[model samples]
Target: MKDGLKQRLVAQARAEGFDACRLCRPWDVRHVPERLAAFLARGYHGQMGWLEERSQWRGAPEVLWPQARTVIMLGESYTPECDPLAGLEQKTSGNISVYARNRDYHDTVKKRLKRLARWLIDAAGGEVKVFVDTAPVPEKPLGQAAGLGWQGKHTNLVSRELGSWFFLGSVFTTLDIETDPAEVDHCGSCRACLDICPTKAFPAPYQLDARRCISYLTIEHKGPVAEELRPGLGNRIYGCDDCLAVCPWNKFAVAAREVKYHARADLVVPKLADLAGLDDAAFRERFSGSPIKRIGRDRFLRNVLYAIGNSGEGALCHVAQAHCEDADAAVADAARWAVLRLRRDANGLE
Candidate 1:
């Protein structure tokens, strides 16, 4: 009976737009707490204070809800239609990560997880609670614990079929579902994801220093980027995809079938000047449904200014100059730094 119910859960998940699903006991990720403790001790999480605050709940899913007997891990692919790294050469334009190029996955994936959860409750008669990345759950480790995928060296889940281009979701339930075999690491000796990081964010083979990650710097970070790391950003105005795009496993990744995951024409490679022109109102309107909107106008411009400083296109100096006195001090600071960098390039300084 448990086996039959678990199979039905997987089928329902796939039918609701999830690419993969697997079951695990709530306490399956035994080693995650230790790894997280070490990571937090090293202060690798940076300003994400909440990760530390919710360490108790994040460290033990069973402790989070003792009554929940099982966890159903789900993965949904949002693989880019074309090469994500190709935007790097288009230096005059901004490069947003492939994940953010489409509609926010949190909402899209959660809706499906909810549908699956509702089905599980109705058919199997169990209480359920769902979580996407919005929670402090150790999803990558849990995903591995449930056989969804292994946590690659980049610390993102990588599967034989989905590579690194997927989002994870979870349904915690009171049902005693049959668990799947845990996935084992298959990264071998390859370090493509680690080496491709422009900021060298990896402290070791599989460890990441979030402070140096471009994705963190451009999004969660609230102020001017550390001056030394700004040039490493290239023209990436949002999250960086270098690590994920360089993974060898991506050869197995097929393009995403969901229409919402398709890139909008303007966002594929937006002109730096055009992006820099966005005022607060325009920024909100332009990014209404985008994950980029969460950072708000000031943080968004701060990232764009960093990209401008890195562009080497002296013509954009005037665009940066216009924002030198921006209301947000961090944005103004970024503008001043960008103008200085572009001016130095104009003067033939190496």
Candidate 2:
């Protein structure tokens, strides 16, 4: 009866549009503590202090919700129809991460997880909790334990069917469900992701130093980006996708079926000039329901200015120069730096 009900739940997850569904016993992720400790010990997380504060709950799911007997892991693909790397050639254009190019996944994935959780409660009569990235849960390890996928060398979950372009969400329930066997790592001598990192953020396979990660530097780090690393960031205004884009498994990735996740035309290759001019109000209005809003106008402009500097197009020099007087020091400094870079590149400064 337990195995039959688990199968039905997995089928329901697929019918509800989740790309894949798998189960793990709540206790399965308990061994993550040692790995988490090592990651922290190496200072890999950088200034993201929250990862340190939530260490206990992050490594052990049972610590967060003891009543949970099973965890249902779900994957939803957000692969773009076009090659996400194509924009990198256009030095003047900003490269937003493929995932952030559409509506925020937090809201979209959370709503679906809630619907699935409610159905489970109604069917089995049990308490449940749902988590996206917002929680302290060690989602990647949990996903692996559930047999959804193994964590690739880049530390993101990669699946045989959907690759690494999918977002993960989990539903924890008190109902005892049969757990699935864990997926084994298939990376196998493949160093494509590591070699492709522009920022060299990965210290070694399976370990990431967030301090040098473009995603963390641009999105999580509050102050100025490290000087030496700024140029390598290029036109990437948001998170970096170079690592994920080069993965060989992505050949199987299908375009997202959910229309809401489809990339917005405006966001695909936004005009750097327009992005640099956004004030707080304009930024909020433009990025409504988008993940880009979380970084706010100042940081967004800072990133844009960095891209403008790297663009090597003299046309955007004026745009960067205008922001040199922005109210935000970070934006203003970035703008001033961009202006200098543009002038140097144009004039062939000695």
Candidate 3:
């Protein structure tokens, strides 16, 4: 009966548009506490202090819900039809991460996880709880234990069939679903992801130092990006995908089938000058339902100014100069820095 129910759940997950579905015992991830501790001890999480606050519960899923006998892990692919790295070559344009280019995945993935959890509970007469990235759960490790994928050297889950261009969600349930065998690390002898990082965020093959991660600096880090590191960020406005894009396993990957996951044409390569003009209200209106809205206007503009500075286009000097007097100190500082960069580019100075 448990095997039959597990099979039904997998089929339903596929029918609902998830790329893959797998099950594992909730206690399967209990062994991850040591690595979790190591990561936290090294302060690799950067300003995401929440990782430290929730470390105890995050490393052990069973602690999160003592009654959960099984965990259903699902993966949703968000691969774009075209290479996401293409915009990086265009210095005047900003490259937004493919994940943030569409409607936020939290809403889309959560709704699906909730619907699936409800269905499982109703069909199997058990209790369940669903979670997306917002939860304290260590999703990547859990995904690994559930056989969805192995934790790649980039520290993101990578599947043999789906590659790394996927989002994960979990459903903890009291149902006794049969477990799938965990996937083995297939990244042996491959350091492509580690070497591809523009900011050199990876300190070791499988370890990431978020402080140096462009994604963290551009999106998560609240203060001024270190002056030395800003150049490596290039024009990436939000999250960095260089590591994911360079993974060889992605060759077999398919573009996202869900229309909601499709990249917005305007977001693909937004003009830095146009983005720098947005105020808080304008930013909210433009990014409504998009992940970029979470960072709010000031931080978003700070990123835009960084891109403008790197653009090396004197034509963008006016935009940078305008933001130099922005009310937000961070934006103003970034704008001032951009003006200097533009000036230096134009007149070959120290």
Candidate 4:
């Protein structure tokens, strides 16, 4: 009966658009508590203080739900149709990470998780819970324990079959299901991900310092990005994909099956000049359904100004100067920074 239910759950998961599905016991991620404590102790989470706020539930799934006997991990692939690094070549444009180039995965994955949980409850008469990335839930570690993939050096799950271009969703249920063996790390000698980080965010092979990470510094971080790290960000206005794109394991990745994740041509290599001009209303309208919308207009423009500064185009200097007195101090500061950098480059000081 347990075996049959597991197969049915996998079928339902794929039917609902998940590309991969696997199972694990609730207590499978045994080392997470101490690992998380160490990471927080080092202040590696940066401005994401929420990770510390919910450490107990995130650190232990069994403690999160003692009644839960099985965890169903799902992977939704969003592999970019082109080289994810292609935007970096077009310095005039901003590099929005492939993950944020479409509708927010939090909304997409949540509905699917709810659908699966409902089915599980009806079939086996057990309670269930669903989680996407927003929760303090340690989805990556649980993903590894579920035989979905191993946590690569970049600290994100990398699947041999799905590569690094996927999102994770989990369904925890009171129903016990047959468990799959955990995946073992395959990142032996390859430093592809570690070497690709522009900000040297990785402290070691499998450790990361979120303070210097472009993704966190751009999105989760408040205020202007640290001046020292701004240049390394280049034109990556949203999240950074350098490490994910450089993974050799992604050679096996296929095109994204979900039509919603297909890149909007306008968003693919959006001109930095155009983005810098977006006011609050225009920003909301432009990024209506995008993951980028959550950062709000001020923070988004702050990132745009930083990119404009790094552009060296100098042609964008006036655009930066125009925003030098933006209503938001961070935006104004970023604008001033961009103006200075561009003016410096104009004077051949760059």
- Best model number under lDDT: 4
Better of 1 and 3 by TM-score: 1
Give the runs in model 4 whose Cα sits over 4 Å from its true position.
none
Give the runs in model 1 whose Cα sits over 4 Å from its true position: 1-3
lDDT of 3 by residue, 58-134 (tens): 88889889999988999999988888889999999999998999899999999999888888877788898999998
lDDT of 4 by residue, 1-350 (tens): 44488788889898998999999998998899999999999999988888999999999999888999999999989999999998998888999999999888889889999998898888877889899987778999999999999999999999999999999999998887898999999998999999989999999999999999999998999998889999999999999999999999998886788888999888998999999888889999999999999999999999989999999898899999999988899999999999999989889995
Model 2 Cα lDDT, one tens digit per residue, 172-265: 9888888899999999999999999998998899989999999998899886787788899999999989989999999988779998888899
- Ranking 3 against 4 by lDDT, winner: 4
Runs of candidate 2 exceeding 4 Å displacement: 1-3
Residue 79 accuracy (lDDT) in model 1: 93
Q: Output the TM-score of candidate 1.
A: 0.98
Worst 10 residues of 2 by lDDT: 1-10
lDDT score for residue 4 of model 4: 83
Model 4 local distance difference test score: 0.92
Cα lDDT tens digits for candidate 1, 10-128: 88888998888988998998898899999999999999999999998899998888999999999888899899999999988999999898689888888998899999988888799
Assess each prediction's global lDDT (C-alpha) against the native. 0.91, 0.90, 0.89, 0.92
Question: Against the correct fold, how does model 2 do in TM-score?
Answer: 0.97
Candidate 4 pairs with clashing backbones: none
